[model samples]
Target: MAHVATWKKDMVSEIVKDITENPVVAVVDLHGIPAPQIQSMRADLREHAILKMTKNNLMLLALDEAAKQRPGIDKLKGSVHGQCAIMATDMNPFKLCKKLEATMTPAAIKAGQLAPKDIMVPKGPTPFGPGPMIGELQKIGLQAAIEAGKIAIKKDTTLVKAGEPVPPGVAAMLPKLNILPIIVGMDLRTVFEDGTVYKKEVLAIPDDYYKTMFATAAHDARALAIDISWTTKETIVPLVTKAFREAMGLSISAAIPTKENIKILLAKADNQMLAVASKSGYKSDAIAARLSSAAAAAASVKPAAEPHKKEEKKVEVKEEEQVSEEDAAAGLSALFG
Candidate 1:
């Protein structure tokens, strides 16, 4: 076998160490980004991750070596392409993806390069003074005119649609118009964690994606638990409260008197008696007021109105003044006469 340099072997060892030690390892594409920007990104990511650049062969070798300790880590070898760098981070794949996305910034489109999106020249004043620049803009299909001693585009124009190559003339005109039509950054390739490889599309998740998922899952879990009555720390209080409410409702509907619902039952019975007396031509002030209110409500028909929850008034009657339940039921007949 040909002799391999000691430095190359040491570099491979270092990469393998990073892959094995860090819980999260990622591959990112650095193609087309400037060196200074990459350095700045490294500083920005210093606290979160360790970005390292090495030969593709060295990285592939490192992946194979790391696969010994981290099974399936070699699956990341495919992401080791041109201008690739690996990062060792403690952040989960989702968070890392978000951080990586923040690195993108507007960059000037070069000649013969593919347009990232439709290049729009709006109808407004431009930064160029009138002269040959007007002709340059017109040559690239812009409706440019000289107004107020400066060149102004006459109408909104799309010089290049998305996925179309930036023609040489259009490319020359864009920089002069101060338009940066392309986005450049470190494009994340894959994330490796616990022998699993997460691709770019999979890792590209909205910031609220997990939060919304967790919230929905928690709500569903609580509802399912209540349905099946599964008891746990988070579900215990709600379950108990629900059970108490159901029991109270059942007692009231079935006229089964209990200490909790006794006062409500008495109030309900009194309302029923008053309703019966009023229907039998009772002319008392209270009956008149109740009837008028009922008529007003029936006329309006407010279906959306919530059930009115009246304040409960406790009346402590003396033992000598107390009336039995049967006497109260027949009490409305006396008011009717």
Candidate 2:
């Protein structure tokens, strides 16, 4: 017995030292794990984390010794009862926790094991057993009648709440309701890293949480890629395609005018603008040229600088001609006389 105690103490010391030195440690409670299942779990955890099973008392003692740096180390002592395993790793805690949950299978439930939450099984008809268990089934809202000397649940009735004690009646009806009171999946008890501690409840994340996280991360990544002009299957394909089409239109006299392509561009714009105009039956080029000529003529018809100069000059010349005619007539008359 003394030797056995010594070995246990040494094992506890090892665990404590390992935890303190390692930057990342995940504490897993192995309570209620069956022997075969534990073996399989060990194999599964081999690649991701180191799994250790130790006594509660030893773990508590080691944690007590290191209370200064790890203040809440004692809290982990409570979860070491029944059968518990400590999983330690340096990987991302949330991701590792998620992967661990994916490796669960159904198992039988034992009495006194705490229910993680309300245990619910649907209401169903119980098979006829004509046995003592039938009485228990009827108490929990299950219908059981004797038929062909066999006991089964005709239909499942939902279990009311988690942690609610399973009455003997309901326990007997388990065969029929197909309700197993065991938590078969992996439960993350706590995670510790970088002198900090995180409990299982906090890390007991849901599928949607990771889904939303990954989705948001993906969106941000795509936005960054676009900002840096890093084209990929995600960003460049669609945006580049749009840019290509726009550039082509600009090159083909179909977009805004520039000095190099102004004439052709304007011509196209003019044709398009006239398409909705009154149908004079004129070709697009003809209509544009006529419009251009009209604009030029309107510009050339600006008001003259001296508005009455030409009119004054014409009046002066007309007066001079009249005067000359008068003078000539006088001379002719005088000569005849």
Q: Which numbered prediction scores highest in TM-score against the true structure?
A: 1
lDDT of 1 by residue, 1-337 (tens): 9999999999998888887899999999998788999999999999989888988999999999999999998999899989999999999998999999999988788898888789888899999897887888888898888899889988898889999999998888787788999777889999998878999899787878889999999999889998899999988998999999999988878889988876566656656655665557667776566556555655465444445955332222222233355544554444544
Clashes per candidate, residues 3 or more apart or on different chains: 0, 27
lDDT of 2 by residue, 44-106 (tens): 777767777766666667667655566666556556655556666767777777766766666
Q: Which residue pairs come into collision in candidate 1?
A: none
Q: Which lDDT values do the candidates have, in the order given? A: 0.82, 0.60
Superposing all C-alpha atoms, what RMSD in Å does each candidate have to the true structure? 7.8, 20.3
After best superposition, candidate 2 residue 273: deviation in angstroms?
A: 6.2
Write down the TM-score of every candidate.
Answer: 0.70, 0.48
**The 10-residue segment with the lowest total lDDT in model 2:** 313-322
Residue runs of model 2 more than 4 Å from their true location after superposition: 1-8, 14-24, 32-36, 39-55, 64-99, 108-140, 145-156, 175-177, 192-337
